[model samples]
Target: MAEEKLPTRAEDFAEWYNQLVVRADLADYAPVRGCMVVKPYGWALWENITSWLDGEFKKTGHVNAAFPTLIPMSFFEKEKEHVEGFAPELAVVTHGGGVELEEKLAVRPTSETIIGHMYSKWVKSWRDLPLLIVQWGSVLRWEMRTKLFLRTTEFYWHEGHTAHVSEEEAKEEMYRILDIYERFCFEEAAIPVLKGTKSETERFAGAQITTSIEAMMWDKRALQSGTSHYFGDNFAKAFEIQFLNKDNKLTFAQTTSWAISSRIIGAMIMVHGDDNGLVLPPRLAPIQAVVVPIFKNDAEKEKVMEVADRIFAELKTAGIRIKMDDRDNVSSGFKFNDWEMRGVPVRVEIGPKDVEKGSVALARRDKPGREGKTFVPQAGLDSAVSDLLADIQASLLKRATEYRDANIHNVEDFEELKQVVQDGWAFSYWCESRECETKVKEEAKATTRNIPFNQPDTEGTCVVCGKPSKRKAYFAKAY
Candidate 1:
C-alpha cells in the first residue's frame, strides 16, 4: 500500500498529531470510546521509559507494590477536597455478579484514598514512619474529551506515595522526586522542561503544595509532563494515620504523592516530532539503529547482507538497540520511509556499491534527506554510529531548547501578556490571587502553568491588576 502524506503541523497540528499516533504504529483507537490500544512497538518504548524510572525510584528507597483496583466509595469521602475534585470522574460499580451491592465500589481514578486507608492501619510507631512505596498500573477517569495518550479515559503511570514523621522529611521527598522527573525529561527524553511550583488553583486536591515540570510543545503550547505533591498531614488526618513519635506523642504522618505518566509520551511527540512523524530521543528509542540492505538481485543481496549482518551484530554487541530490515518484497525507499516514520535515530544502508567500497550510508532521522546522510567506513562502524547517535541526541536537545527559549516572552502589561500567549508563553509578575488568575484565563484562553523557583531580586507590579507582586509565573495555552 502506498503511504499517505500527513498534514503538516502548521496546516493543522491537531490532525497531524492524531494521524501520526496511528500512522507511526505507536497506538490505535480502541473499540471503546476514549480508550487506546498500545501496539507492540509502543509498548517497547514504554518499557524503556518505565525501566529507567523504576530503577531511579528503587535507588531512592522506594519499593514497588500493588493496590486494589476497586476502592470503597466511602474511602473517597474521607478526604473532602480530593473527593470533590474527582467526583465527576469516578466510575462506580453498583452491581457485581448479578447482585446489587450494599455500597458502590469506585474504579480507582487514583489510589490516594485506598492507599491512605492502608497506611492508617499499617502505621503505629515512629519506627514505621517513612513508608515509601510506588505503584505501577493503569487508572480510569470518565474524561469527556480524550486524545490518544495525552488525555485518555484510562492511562498508565507510576503513582508514588510516601509518609514521614516530620514535615521536613515529607517535603524533602517531594522535591527529590521532582528532581528525578526533571532529570529524566532532560537526559533520557531530550526535552527541556521548567521545574516550578503550581499555583493554588492548579495544585492537586488535598495537597498543601504541588510542583511540576512543564514543557513547551512544537506549537508553543505547554504540557505539564510530571507532578510531585506534598500533603502536610491533610490525608494523614483524614485517614487517621497516627503514630507514636520519638517523643512518645501521637502525631499525624506527613505525606507526599508524585507521578510521571504516559502523558509524557505525548509531550515527546510534540516537542521533537516533525511533519513526517515522531522524532524519538535516542536513549529512549526502542530501535536506535536499523540496517537496510540495498540490492537489485540475489547476487547483490548476498554481498550486501554479508556486510549488513556484520555491522548489525557489531552494533548490537556494543549495547546498541539494532534491527536488520532485509525484506525482499518492499522497495528500499519504502523501508527508508517506514523507519523514518518510526523515528529510529540512525539508518545504515549497505548496498552492492557500499559492500565493495567497504562503507555504509548513515541517515539521521532528526535531519531528513541529504543533509543528514553520511558515508562511513565499515572498519570501525560501531564507534562511528555511536558517536552519530550521541550527536543527534545533543542536537535535538539544543534545537528544542532554543525553540522554547525564543518563544517565551517577558510581558510588562496585560495587553502584552494577552498577545504573547496567543502564540507562545508569557512570563509576567502576578499578584497570585484567584480573581486575577481567573480573569486571564477567561479573557486570554491561557492558564497559569507554574510559578518557577527562579525569580527576580526586585518585586514588580502585577501584569493584570497593577498590584505589587513578588514573583512571576508562566501563562500559556495548554494541551
Candidate 2:
C-alpha cells in the first residue's frame, strides 16, 4: 500500500487536519457515529496530560474520586438552568433489561448535578465546608456536528468540583484552576492563549462567571482550550447543599467546576502541525526522540545498529522517551518519514560513516528541511538531544504566539470587525449586552471570544450598537 500525502493546510486546513490525525496514528473514526477510537499513541499523549494535571490537582488539596456515569433525570432537574442547557445534548437511557425505566438516566455530559447531589448528602456542617474532588472520565454529549477529538460524541476529560463555605473561596479556586490551565497550554502544549472571563452569553449555564483559556489555531480560529466556572451558591442551593457555619447558622455552600478535555489534542494539532505532518511539543510527544539506524547492507547495519542501540539506551537512562528503529526490512528514508509523521521531537540518525566518525546526525521536527538537521558528537549526545528538544518546545510556542499576536486587530466599527474576523481576531469595545453580541454573531458569523482580563481600560462606543462600552472583547470565528 502506498502512503498518502496530507492535503496542504493552506489550501484546505480541515482536510489536512483530518488526514494528519489518522495518518499519524493518533485516532480514527469509531464504528459508532460521532465517536473516535483513540489510538494507543493518542492515548499516551492524553496520559501524559492526565498525569501532570492530576499532580497539580493533588498539590492544590484536591483528590481523585469516581462518580457514576449514569445520573438520574431528577438530579438534573434540581438545577433548572443546567437541565435546560444540557437537555438537547443529553443521551438518555430509557430502558434497562428490556423494561422501561421509571425515571430516565442521562449519560454524563458534565458531572455537576451528580457531584452536587453527592456533596449535598456528604456536607452537614462547617467542618466539611470545602470538598475538593476530581473525576477523570468520559462524557457523552450528542454533538450534531462532530470533528474527531475536537467535538466527539464521547470524549475523555477531567472535571474538578469543589464546595466551599464562602463565595470568595469558590472564586479563588476557579482562578487558581484557570491559571493552571493557562500554564499547561503555554508550557506543555506549546500553544499561547488568552485568559479571561467569558461574556454573559458565552458563560457556562448555571455559572455565575466562567473563565477560560482560548488559543488561536493556525487557521486563525479560536479554540476554547479549557474553562473554570464559579457557581457561587446556585448549584448548592438547587441541590440543597448546606453547611452550618461557625456562628451555628446554616447557609448554602459555594461551588466551582473546571474542566479540560481531549479537545486540547485538536488545538495542538492545529497550532503546530505542518504540511508534512504533526509537530508535537517535546513535553507531550509519546516518543521524544527516535533513533533511525541508516544502513545499505548487513555490514553497515551491524555498525549503525550498534551505535543506535547505545544512543537509545543512553537517552532512555537519561529519562527521555526514546525509540530505536532497527527493522532491517524498512529503508532508512522510510523510517525517517515515519518518525517525522509521528512528530517525534528529535530524530537521531546513525549511519556507518557517521559511526566511524564517532558522531550522529540530529534533525528536529519543528524546523523545516535540512536547515534543522545538525551533527553532534557521540560523547555528549544526551545533552545535545536534551538541549534540542527544549529548543523545539520553546520555539513552537514562540512561533504560535507570533502568529496569534500579528493577526489580532483592533477595529472601531461592525464592518471593520466583520472584515478583520474573516482572517484573524477582532478586538473591539462591546456594550456587554446580549442584543449587540447576537447582532455581531448573526451578521459576521463571529462571537466574542472573551473579555480579556488584562487588556487596558479604555472608553469607546460599542462596535455593533454604538452604545457606551464597558470593556473590549475579542471577537473571532472559532472551532
TM-scores for all predictions: 0.99, 0.98
lDDT by residue (tens digit), candidate 2, 1-479: 15557789999999989888898899999999999999999999999999989989999999999999999988888888898899999999999999999999999999999999899999999899699999999999999999988999999999999999898999999999999999999999999999998998898989999999999999999999999999989999899999899999999999999999999999999999988899999999999999888888888878888888888999999999998887878777777777777888899989888999998889999975677799889998999999999999999999999999999998998898999999999999988999999998999999999998886666888999898887898999998
lDDT of 1 by residue, 1-479 (tens): 34567789999999999989898899999999999999998889999999999999999999999999999899999898999999899889999999999999999999999999999999999999799999999999999999999999999999999999999999999999999999999999999999999999999988999999999999999999999999999999999999999899999999999999899999999999997788999999999999999999888888888888888999999999999998989999989888888889999999998988999999999998667899989998889989989998999999999999999999979998989999999999999999999999999999999999989898998999999999999999998
**Winning candidate number (TM-score):** 1
Give each prediction's root-mean-square deviation over alpha carbons: 0.8, 1.0
Candidate maximizing lDDT: 1
Candidate 2 vs. true structure, TM-score: 0.98
Q: What residue runs in model 2 are displaced by over 4 Å at the alpha carbon?
A: 1-3
Q: For each candidate in the order shown, give its overall lDDT on alpha carbons.
A: 0.94, 0.92
What is the alpha-carbon lDDT for the whole of candidate 1?
0.94
